[model samples]
Target: MSSPVTPSLTYRSPPGPLHATLLAGTVPLFLGALLSDIAYYNSYQIQWSNFASWLIAGGLLFCGLALVFALVNLVRAPKKAGRPLVYFLLLLVMFVLGLVNAFEHAKDGWAVMPAGLVLSVVVTLLACVTAWMGLNLRSGGPA
Candidate 1:
C-alpha cells in the first residue's frame, strides 16, 4: 500500500527590489509633506508650503511607479481573487489621491492651506496603507 500523494502549492512571489524600494519611498515623502503642511498651517510660512509641494511631487512620482508595478503584478498573477487585487486597488486609490493632493498643493498662498493640509493628511494615510498592504500581503494557492 502506498501513502497518499499531497498536492503541490504555489505562492505569490514577493515584490522585486525596485518595486519594494518604490513603495517604501512613498510613505516618508507623503508623511513629510503632511508635516510640512501642518507646519505651514501653524506658522504661515511660505517656505513650508514650498517644502510640502516638493515632497508631494516626490511622493507622487514614487507612488505612480509603484502603482505600475502593482498593476503588472496583478495582471501576471495566476490567481487574482485575493490580496493581489486588493493591493492593486489600494495602490490605485493612493496614486489618485496623491495626484489630487499634488494639484491642491500647486495652488497659491491661502488657497493652498486648509484643503492642502487636509489632502496631505489623506494622501499620507493612504500611502501608509498601500505600502503596508503591498509589502506584507502574499497570495498563494494550489498549482
Candidate 2:
C-alpha cells in the first residue's frame, strides 16, 4: 500500500499574522495623520484640533516604541529584519525632514501649519508596522 501523504514543515512559519497586524496598525496611523491634515483645511488659522494633533502625536509615540521593541527582538531573527530596519531609518529621515519643514512653514505662511508633521507621523506609522512584521515573524522562527 502507498504511504499516506504528509505535509512537510519548515524551519520558519508563515508571516501572515504579523503582516496583518502591521497593516492594521498602519491604516489607522496613516488615516489619523491624513484626517488631521484635512481638518486643518477648514480655516485660515491653519491650526489643528487639539484632539487630532494629540491622536497623531500618539501615533508617533506608538511607532517609535514599536520600532524599538522590534529591533530588540530582531537579534534572533533572520534576513527579514533587514527590510524593517530600512523602514526605521527611513522613518527617522522623514521625521528630521518634517522638523526642518516646520521651520519653513513658519516662514512661508502656509495654510496648513502642521502639514509636514502629519506626513511625518504617517511615515512613522508605516515604518513601525514594517518593523513589527519583521520582528514577530523571524524572531519566533527557528534560529
Among these predicted structures, which one has the highest TM-score?
Answer: 1
Give the RMSD in angstroms, all C-alphas superposed, for model 2. 6.1
Candidate 1: C-alpha lDDT: 0.88
Clashes of each: 0, 0
lDDT per residue for candidate 1 within 1-143, as digits (tens), equals 99999876658578999999999999999999999999999999899999999999999899989989998998998788688888888888888888888888888887997999888888888888888878876778531
The ten-residue window of minimal lDDT in model 1 covers 134-143
State the C-alpha lDDT per candidate. 0.88, 0.48
In angstroms, the error of model 1 at 109 is: 0.4
- List model 2 lDDT by residue over 1-143, tens digit each: 99998765334433345544543454465456556556655544445444344555555555455445555434434455444445446545544543443343344334345555555455555545554544444322233
What are the TM-scores, per candidate, against the unseen true structure? 0.90, 0.50
